[model samples]
Target: MDISEIAITAAMASGFIAIHLMVRRLNFLDATPRSGWLSFAGGVAVSYVFLHVLPDIALHQREFADGMGVGAKEAESIIYSLTLAGLAVFYGLERAVKMSRGESRKAGEGDKMGNRVLYLHLVTYGTLNALIGYLLLHREDAGAWSLGLYFVALGLHFFTADFGMRQDHPEAYDRLGRWVISAAVLGGWVLGLVVDLSPVLVGCLFAFLAGGIILNVLKEELPEERQSYFMPFVVGVLLYAGLILAERHWV
Candidate 1:
């Protein structure tokens, strides 16, 4: 990688890791700031999907269809299919994790099945972080300012993730979650440096991540236990959305 690429990767990886550690101290997830920062993060992530990521998906899918001489409708269907698959997979994963957590509370070690469930959740979480890290590098080539904004939104989203994981499995998350998942971001950047994904594959990654972001952010925000603030959510939506909009128009 060139100097610019390396710098972007380092900054984003450090930022992602820093946020996870910061949340443990700041308690942004469970505290009053949850309404402001957490809600804003959730809104920013959602707006990123609707405003920027989804449109890119549509554009890429169209380009893929044209390049392959396929029907536009078929291409659209295929893209949506992958998107739904991504959503369903994460949804199922979260449900299984919740069930395992409940069982763990009930039957001691919750048996081997419960252990496996937590393992799967952490593995998936780490893998997703890596994917996002890789995509961050890809986005940097577009513009530094755009990448900076992306980092802000993603860093905040990861903050909420750290909080949720720590809340769900305090001991396990503290001992393993922070280090492992933080490393995953760096690992993903290295993998991205070596492996050059095709445009279609990159689009698939974006689609999968878009689904994951939507699911994870909403899971944190919509719960009555969260006590999220309306204005912060609105502020986040408008603030991040306006940044993305400005980039779309000017950059």
Candidate 2:
């Protein structure tokens, strides 16, 4: 990467860390009616996945097929299978965390999660952050504009995600989780600087991220308990999608 790319990636890495460190202070997101801004962030994230990440999956499928001398159908199966695996893995983790919480409540432990469950959640999310950090340097299109778009989408995503994390494990997340995740981001970026992986592997990583993002956003929004705002979510989707399309068309 050139100096400009390095600088941008560093700034984005810092931004990710800052989001985690400071998300709790965004008190408006904790509104009872479900903050429109949080919902809006979710929408932007989902839109990015559909507009940018999913399409990139198709390209990766083609490349993987070509590289492996496999047929298109086989490549699609391979790539989509990874996506499914990503979704399934995170779903299982989520269920485990919720179940842990429920069990704690049943035991009259006041909704506290076990250390094992907490560690599992932290590890899973830390890996996710690390992959995101690695991608900061290794995106398919490494232009400054692409980096900016990515930072905006995922920055908002981190905002919403941190909110959820705090709600789930307030004490642990504030005390230790944020620092681990923040370090994971910088660690992944540093790894990217020194360790080059195959393009096919990077594509697979992105496919996993696509599935994770979809699951994460929907889980937060679809629950009746959340009382999330719908119009702001729609606005976020439309506005970010328009920006992406305009960028593609004009830039």
Candidate 3:
């Protein structure tokens, strides 16, 4: 099998194993930390794309990418562009969506997971995960050192994101959500290899997540009665926002 197949299979098996453990171990599963971690897994998947793996791919490809220089400056420039574009578009959509409802961030209010919003979350999260997989697995052009570093970064990011999220929201997890998220992340990672579109597709992933984040931000402004399972996603989106903004304006 090729790299894609290997990556897909490993992700599925591992994710499933994680899910199974959650199901067997947790009682009153709905209030467990599993869901938060699951939600975080998705975020971690996306972060792997945005923070480490994607940049390495982008930098390596830049050399042959329309004659772009294979220099740190060029890599920084590309990351900056994606970051700015990602954050700007995210906030813009958030504002536009909020305008219709006269929304404001009142702390603890939740966004409605309307069909549009749910679809936004799934597609964006999937796309982000897929795009990263595409660049990393397909870019046979990358060296082992950078690739190893990228994987290390991905591992740490995933671990930290999941742990922190689990700590923040002790009530969001359960066996059902745990399996669902575990399946989603692992399955999503594997599927991403197959649906591997292009580097440009990564941009679409960011855009999709940006829309969902905007929706979550709107929800966060609502009254307590309206709160839901969206805060996890909102937090993930915010992380992406921070990373992208930093990549663009700060770094």
Candidate 4:
């Protein structure tokens, strides 16, 4: 990547780490009090998928079909299949982690196993951040304003992810989780600079990311423990969705 691309990536990586660290410092908002913000963040993320990413994926799939002389419907089916597969993969990961946790608890190794699960989850999330960072470089030609908006949306999304992880593994997240994800964003950007992905591969990455975001956000919300504020959640959805739509029109 050139200096401009490197600067853009660095800004994004800095944003990721800064927002996360700032939120972590607010220890008073721990546990249930954080739910409203988490809900709002989830709404914003899910909106991005419905309004922005999914449409792009559809176009990419259509292009793939045309290039290969396949039926449009068939290509669409494949795209959705990949999305479902992505969802299933993360769901399986959660299930496996939970199962291991239960077994560990029974075996009197609960603390050790919990730490292991937290490590794995953080690493996986960090890898996802890296993927996103790397992908941002491809949008270098798309203008600065669009790129800025992308970082804004993603930085907000990362705030929620940080809060959720901290709630789940407070000590470990404090000790290592934050740094891991922060580094992941930078690492991913570096990798992106070194590698150019094909359209098909890019589509796959987005599909998997969309699925993961949907799953992770919802998983945090559904638990009865959250006591999330419904109105704020709806407001978040509308507010962020409007911003995204307005940005699209302005561009």
Candidate 5:
């Protein structure tokens, strides 16, 4: 990586760490109707996935086909299956947390998730954060502008994620979870600096991330309890999608 890439990635890392460390301070997101900003952030993240990530998956499919000497159809199926696996894995994790929390409540332990659930949740997201860090240096398009766009979309996604995490395990998340995940982000970036992964591996990771992003965003936005703002979400989708198209055409 050049000096500029280093600088940008460092900033991206810091931004992610800050979201974990500082998300609780953003009190407005706690509103009953749900914050427009969170909805807007969700929309931006989804737009990035559809407009940027899905298209990139086609490129990765080509890489996978070449690397494995497989047919294009077979490679495409493999890439998409990984995406589905990513979504299913996180969905299962979410179910586990909710079940744990429900069991705890039944036992008159209030709304807290059990220690096992808390640990599992933290470890899983920590790994995801690390993957984010690693991909900072190894994304499909490593241009400065691409890095900036990735940071913006994922940074906002982190806000919604942090909020949900805090909701799930208020005490545990505040005390220890955020720190662990924050360090994971930096740890993954460091791993990227030292370890060179194959293009096929990176593509697999990207596909997984795309699935996770879709699940996380929808889980937050689509629930009836959230009362998410539709107008802001629509505006976010239109604006960011336009920006991406413009960038592709001109930049």
Candidate 6:
């Protein structure tokens, strides 16, 4: 990595440390906050789409056309075709693997390790998805769709680490997960520089999903038993959309 990469890594590290220091109320946290997790997941998915993929796609629009030099219609079809081709094949392989595994019987009772393995498996697939998006940014002229997928990838990062920390550091929110996530801050920024990608979307996504704390003001919230679970999702989309819109238009 060059000096820029080093600087980015350092910046990310500082950010990670700062963020970890803020999960102060985890002692009162519950891992089964499904609404919060779902909201988190959606926000993360958006993050991946916008951050890594968008800029790459913008760059690509000016680059190579499909192997055949064709008109605008042909270009779009080719782009969508190529995009769906990879995702389709991947989805198919994934289904096949899941089917095979589903058919296999477990020899022993599942334990924490089994659960963690499942999480790791899902996270690993997500990481690969991001990497593939990164590679597409390099090789293909993927446009808006690539942008969308990139945000999805960055979102996956937020989802995994945040969700993992929920489970891993239940009583103690500052464990190795803290260190790991902290490392990812600078690490991600550094990698962005190394890959020659902009860090704007990724960093903001990180700031948003892993960004702040939720203060459920009893006076501000609906009745405890009557609280609508949809609040988190609404908050999530609104936050992201607002951010995107503002950055594009308002700002």
Candidate 3 matches the true fold with a TM-score of 0.41
Query: Each candidate: RMSD to true structure?
Result: 2.5, 1.1, 10.0, 2.7, 0.9, 10.0
Best by lDDT: 5
Q: What is the TM-score of each candidate against the true structure?
A: 0.91, 0.97, 0.41, 0.85, 0.98, 0.46
Worst 10 residues of 2 by lDDT: 139-148
Per-residue CA lDDT of model 2 for 1-87, tens digit only, reads: 688778878988999999999987888788877899999999999999889877777967778898768998998888888888888
Where model 4 places Cα greater than 4 Å from the true spot, the runs are 66-69, 104-112, 139-141
The total of clashing pairs for model 4 equals: 0
Global lDDT of each candidate? 0.78, 0.88, 0.43, 0.72, 0.91, 0.40
For model 6 the TM-score comes to: 0.46
Candidate 6, 17-56: lDDT as tens digits: 4645555444433433444644544554444344433444
Candidate 1 per-residue C-alpha lDDT over 126-152 given as tens digits, one digit per residue, 9 for 90 to 100: 989999888877751267776777788
**Backbone clashes (count) for model 6:** 16
lDDT of 4 at 91: 77
Error of 5 at 227 (Å): 0.9
Is candidate 2 or 5 superior in lDDT? 5
Residue by residue across 57-151, what tens digits does model 4's lDDT show? 88677775875568888877777777787677767767656676677678986433365667678778887888878768864225676676667
Q: What are the clashing pairs of model 1?
A: none
TM-score winner: 5
How high is the lDDT of residue 18 in model 1? 83
lDDT of 3 at 201: 45
lDDT for position 185 in model 6: 48
